[model samples]
Target: MIRIGTLNVGSMTGKSREVAEMMNTRRVDILCVQETRWRGNKAKEIGGGWKLLYSGADENSRSGVGIIVNSELKEKVVEVKRSCSRIMKVKLMLSEEVLNVISAYAPQAGCDEEEKSMFWRELDEVLTSISEEERVVLGGDLNGHIGTDRRVISRIHGGLGMGRGTKKAKAS
Candidate 1:
């Protein structure tokens, strides 16, 4: 089985020592990191044995993504997309299978009703493109409390989800 880990590091510069310490202690086969604040000139291979693949913080602090693979592992980047913010594509060479991983950090809020709907609707469309049959995995700080309620309330529990989060999770 593939062991994967995702962490919203909240700006590595804010906690660089903590981030490095955690990574050193964990034996993560594949790691997805967000809010790295990585820069074009400053980002480099860190830690002793990690084969690093990463990108910097984009304008508006939009895209900051990083992936780490065991240096002994054979791998290549399949596709990289910085198009819609921090979503990037990387493919891994497992012993017997090729795995595809997408690292994403989505937009946090919208100004109005139309904008809010449009934002999530776009996320849904993107999710539809992936095939479950492929060895594909998505990891990042989605920033949506869909899987876990922030207020600890569900619609059935008298919350204001309006069943939107539930439907999106089911469909995609």
Candidate 2:
């Protein structure tokens, strides 16, 4: 099976090598990276036989997302979609099936409501656009709160989450 993982790099500058090494050590085939803070929509080879496909805002370096593919699966990449600075997707051909890998960075808790709404709306659009027959692997920093207490949500949460739940988390 293909191993997939997610990471919030904070900023990708000067950290490609470290990221690649971590992936190799963990034996991860695909990694979704967030908060890259890089400006541009492009792909780069970050050594250790890994490739990074990223998308960032042209005017700022605040938000970005990317997907890292190891050498074994790099050649299977068929399409790349840079939805925005906060979202990106890569399609891979695995045998007879298609795998869509999406990397996303949601607005932080301090962000305005409008920005948060837009981020969620855009993410929903991207997710809905894909067909059900295709495989989907979505990973990212969604900026959600599960609270330290798992008594209420034990079925979905594993009791390792930190912090207290906010009104938003309770509403959801």
Candidate 3:
């Protein structure tokens, strides 16, 4: 099985080596990085035989997302799609089936409601477009918290969440 992971790198300009080292150390096959802060859409080989596919707003240093594939799985890449700075997708051609991996960076809790709703709407569109038979994996820094109160959302949460309840949580 492939070992997938996600990280919010904050910025990636001069931290390529550090990120590569972490991937190698963790033995990660596919890594989804958020908040890259890089302003480009391109793929490059960052040492340790890793390939990074990144997308960001043009000429802007704000939101960004990317996916890194190890040398072994690098050749299996089928398609890469970048919808915006907050969302990206990478499809891998596996031996028996295709795997779709989505990397997303959602607006933080402090952001406006419209921004947050838009992020979810975009992400929902992406998720719904994929076929049921294909494997889909989503990873990223989705800012929010599921508190210990599981009775209200037991269907969604497993009752193992940490942190105290927020005003919204208590109200819900």
Candidate 4:
């Protein structure tokens, strides 16, 4: 099975190699990265046969999103869409199946409501554009909270999420 993951890299200026290394060690085939703060839309090779396709504002380094594909999957990319600085998507041909991977960065909680609304609207448009038969995977830092209670969303949440300030299990 193809392994996929996501991360909010904060800024991608000097972290491409490090991110690629981490993905290699983890055996991830595809990675969605957000908050790249990169300007312009372009694809760059980040060493070790990994490629990063990113989209960002032309004039500023603010919200941005990107997808990293390992050597095995890089050439399978069929289409790339940059919805905005905060959202981007890549379509890959995984054998006979089509996989649409999206990377997004949502506005923070304190941001104006209009901005947040626009982000959701754009995201919805992206989701609707994909064909029903195609597979979809979204990864990003959505900056949302479901509170400590999961009774309302247990069907989707699995009721295993930790509340704020909860200690994480140590990796042994």
What is the C-alpha lDDT profile of model 4 across 1-172, one tens digit per residue?
9999999999999999999999999999999999999998999999999999999988765688999999989999999999999999999988889999999998875578899899999999999999999999999998776555555664544333357433457999
Per-residue lDDT of candidate 1, residues 1-172 (tens digit)? 6667888776656554455556667866667777666664222455655655676744646447776665554244455444243555567656676677766665554334574566456556555665666587888876554333324444323232333433335664
Question: How many clashing residue pairs, candidate 4?
Answer: 0
The reply for model 3, stretches above 4 Å from the true place, is 147-172
Total colliding residue pairs, candidate 3: 0
Model 2 scores a C-alpha lDDT of 0.90
Q: Give the Å shift of residue 2 in candidate 3.
A: 0.7
Supply the TM-score for candidate 1. 0.64
TM-score for every candidate vs. truth?
0.64, 0.84, 0.83, 0.84
For all candidates, what are the clash counts?
0, 0, 0, 0
Query: Whole-model Cα lDDT per candidate?
Result: 0.59, 0.90, 0.88, 0.90
Candidate 2 versus truth, CA RMSD in Å, comes to 6.8
lDDT of 4 at 116: 86
lDDT of 1 at 50: 60
Question: lDDT value for candidate 1?
Answer: 0.59
Give the number of colliding residue pairs in candidate 2: 0
Q: Of the pair 1 and 2, which is ahead by TM-score?
A: 2
